[model samples]
Target chain A: MANTHISYTALPGRSRPYFGVLYLVELVFTFGLLAIGERTRLYLGPDHLLVLRRRFFTETAHRFYFSDIQAITVQRTTNAVTANAVLFLLCALTLGVLGLYPFSGGMILLGDFSFGEELLLILACAGFGLGLALNILLGPACVTELITAVSREPLPCLSRWGTAQRALALLVPRIETAQGVPSPEFLNVQPVLAAYATPAGRLITQPPITHDSGRLHELLFGLYLLMSVSCMIDLTGNWMIKNAFDSLLFMIVLVLSCIALLRQRHSDIPSDIRSLTGFALGFSVLLFYFTRPFTMLHMFWNMPENFDPAILMSSMLNPDDPLYVAYVGTQLAVDLFVGLLGLLGIYRFRRLYRLAQHNAALDTPPPPASNVEEPPAAP
Target chain B: MSTALTAWSGTACPRCGREMERLPSNSVEPRVCPHCKTSFIALLFPAAVQNEFLGRYGEPLREESEAACFYHADKRAETACDRCGRFLCALCAIDTQDKRYCPQCLENGIRSGELPEFQSAYPRHDLLALAVACIPLMLAIPILLIVLPWATDIALGFALGLLLFPAFVTAPASLYLALRFRKTVTHPLGRRAGWFPLTVLLAAGQMVVWAVAIIVFTGSLFSEF
Candidate 1:
């Protein structure tokens, strides 16, 4: 047997989004890679493959020994498609801005920045361009899974097809050496044993035990619609428009979105609805903070002689500036669009979920009814 | 519970439970599952063919001399539970790693976290140390960015003061974390051990820088008074 203990190689790839909204925070604060998020790295160890998953302060290590690993599976995901579209859009926008720079004179319309600051901004764009290049060059994204008899673990770093194949190249040899190659007689086995093994009493599909998630999806989307409309109306500043309720509506949507997201995490609701729930939450956050720096700058420029604490808060809340209106107005428009999409997603999800539940109900044998009814109640 | 513990045999497309085509020993090309059309690469080992368990139905008591299982009065005892010393039949005996425990003892072990392998996750001292060592500097970047371009001398002095004040707290805290968490289960690839030491070194360097800056700052303040 080969000594499976001495040499360890760090597998390629880092588990994180092609782009996380959190990356914006990193870009703003650190000006580093616009793609840094939770990093879950894989290591080929002597005895076992170790998965080091780092999130916040906690690190979880999951070890899978080569002898016990029954199989390795890699499946394609739509993450690459989504990432490519977003990056392409970003690249186009940045290129357009850069194109306009010469025609617009030296004055930047967004804000007055010093030479050093402009240099930093240009460097940040280069970073985003590099990210777009990397995303495209990597080709399609995939999720690689290592299956043992008792556990199936996702290897996050091998998130791309090319990297996953390379990972398999390293892993296959080690695993094969650990457990000798199967005999020719069983070489073409068509997972007949897997069908038999279905972990004993469990069926191929799980028994549906879904309860209506109290229409959390509907309520969430309804709130999204309400907030989107209210914010838009507030911007109009028309006659008798209740602008103060805008913040209240925002808070309601924020809370409801979080609750709805968590509640529907493992539900039978269609994936599209769940994705929209997440998007609604994210877009809501974007709406809240995307205009923050611009507003803050406006406040700094318009600072009164006597800077009262109350004035600062009130001023920020109602910037009363044309730029704030433009920025915030665009944000509200997008929020309204997402909210409308969310409502559409929820309708589709309800239809799908109900049909699934109906089918499941039809498939399941009536245990209680069969046991209690004798076809003749002693009437 | 049985459904939850369904062994995730690499037999099916995970998304849809359609049986995936198993690769022959030599075939390494990935294939998409026909049902889900999800591209998948699956390799089934020798163990996948063999039944993991035949049946754990404990043998009925045949001879009066055999000690009966504690859980099953009629079943013969196969082994003594390693934790509680209870006689357990094959059905009740839960074998985990080197230890064999009865169902009750195993549940207790898991709940109380007496077993190290079962613990889900814990804070990495090395990473905590790293955060402490690096976060102040990370924060300094944004402050310097915002304040620096307005005026060079004012920005320099202001940023230094801000960095120095935080460094006094963060640098020492980082050192403490590094020393305290010296024995954290480091990285498997031998890359696990460096973060703590790096944090300690960075903390020490930060302390030195902060001390000089604070001294100059205080000296200037006092000189002005």
Candidate 2:
């Protein structure tokens, strides 16, 4: 795959300096958020931290509002990032403690083990980790890139022009303002009728247009927002108990990076890349979700009798205790549910990307009546 | 009348049906087609032509003729003749089933078939080549007898022959024919008998070696006792 990494730096309307600043701010804040969320979860033990993580989704759902506020408030605010970063760091530390589990395999204290075996095992783990990360990142990038490429090209993106957009525009002239009018040149109202004319001598018109896009978009964005929030909650709650601030910070940064993805709405981001990223992000969250239960069951519960939980615990909460089992099971169920929801989010993102292309096509201007007329007799 | 002509020639929109002031001919700015009032993009082919390109380029035209076989006049073929366009009808076609073969497919198909009788006159001599390769394996028992002790010598004789016979006759022959002819050859006679020639030669050589090893080893054992 000869793939290009779409740089936000290349968008037409924006300047390089502005984008650079945004990137830096975005990255720092994102990292900080992840760190905080992770730390909080570690301290709070999956349950309490998850409640905090739900805020991110709520924040994302209200991003348009946040964007307006952020655009105004943070426009020149230089000092906010520092305070946020510090808080994020504290949370990340706590979350990190919770993020970590006793290493899944029992402690191997054999000092004289063969070099080859150790080397192979380490190599295997590193390879697996790298592959996991690649799947996490590359999948979404590929989809969005393809969507952008196809949309920017010459072919009309609409599934049906004559029957849908034209009919819709003609029947409900009022709705035309919302859909916006196509350029008159590409849409030859006269020829379209002539091409698929009825037996009647008069021009034929298709019935009123009905686009189900609004409901679809609402459904998708809603699902995505829900899933993302749930995952955030699950991670945060777990991290609060463990005190792993680093993991929390990483998740915070991840949420911020998603803002760049929302730029797809403003500019034409490729659908393939968006889908790929959605799948990757969704799947990574899913992996982390599955890993949590597996880690607790395999690593903590089965740890050597003498192993200390102090390094892993931000609080005195014992996950193996009967009191915590309900919490663990609840978190696991939520994680699974969100993992499934993320898949639905991916589907919605694809559906929306396609709809954007369609709307863009509908937005194209129609061709003139004279141009639609059969070219003057050849001779 | 003159202004209408000027407007049509210069600044008509292809999409939104809006007319615009005609700019200088050399201007690179994209204009809206006046009739449909659609704004066309710059640095791209027109939309209608682009759709045609996507749908039809490199696609087969309906006017293109279907391929026919050489031997079987009635049979319609899919692949074309490498040299000639003549349709080979069913009766005139060679059915190499996986691939359609015309009369000229010999050079490709020859190695896939067995060597002709005229080329190799010594039909039975072919068995000698099998014996030469098998002889070394058959003699493994005698060598083992000399290398090791008398007690295991007889058993080694049978083991060496059994392993050598199949490997020499079956694997090598099948592999060679597959590589050479590309087509698998089947014996019209007893299916195993065609290969049996090679196996028998190899087996006889192995038996001779085994008997010699047994006698030498057993006699030596008696002498030692």
What is candidate 1's CA lDDT for residue A254? 85
- Model 1, docking class: acceptable
User: Candidate 1: misplaced stretches above 4 Å?
Assistant: A1-7, A18-38, A104-124, A182-187, A192-379, B1-26, B32-38, B54-123, B151-158, B183-192, B213-225
lDDT by residue (B1-225, candidate 2, tens digit) is: 011111111133322223455333212233444322233321111121122222211222233264435444345654554434445544334444244444555343444332221121112222233433444443454445333432365667565665455554544553343344322232111122244445455455555655677799899999999
> Residue A277 of model 1: what lDDT?
67
TM-score, candidate 1, first chain: 0.63
Alpha-carbon lDDT, every model: 0.66, 0.33
Model 2 residue A13 CA deviation (Å) reads 38
Candidate 2 lDDT over residue span A285-338, tens digit each: 544554455345444433555666664442324443322343334334443443
Q: Give each prediction's DockQ, rounded to 2 decimals.
A: 0.23, 0.01
Give all TM-scores, in the order shown: 0.61, 0.24
- Model 1 residue pairs with clashes: A4-A46, B187-B192
The whole-model C-alpha lDDT of candidate 1 against the native structure comes to 0.66
Name the regions of candidate 2 deviating beyond 4 angstroms: A1-121, A128-221, A235-269, A272-278, A281-379, B1-225
- Return the interface RMSD of the candidates, in order shown, one decimal each: 6.8, 29.7
